[model samples]
Target: MADDMTDNMLILSMISQVFALILRSSFLSGGLGDA
Candidate 1:
């Protein structure tokens, strides 16, 4: 049970990281395009 919980937490963390990265890049691209 503990192992399963840990795996789920890891997956969540990875997904969050990917989402953050996408947001960051999109913001940067948008700013550059505006200028």
Candidate 2:
């Protein structure tokens, strides 16, 4: 049970990080394009 919880937390953390990275990149690209 503990192992399963840890795995789930890790997966969630990875997904959140990926989402943040995508958002940051998109914002940067848009700013660069405007300039």
The alpha-carbon deviation from the true structure for residue 24 of candidate 2, after best TM-score superposition, in angstroms, is 0.2
Error of 1 at 9 (Å): 0.4
Local accuracy of candidate 2 as per-residue lDDT tens digits, 1-35: 99999999999999999989887887888854653
Clashing pairs in 1: none
Using all chains and alpha carbons, the TM-scores for the candidates as numbered come to 0.82, 0.79
Best by TM-score: 1
Q: Residue 27 lDDT in model 2?
A: 87
* Model 1 per-residue lDDT tens digits across residues 1-35: 99999999999999999989887887888854654
RMSD of 1: 3.8
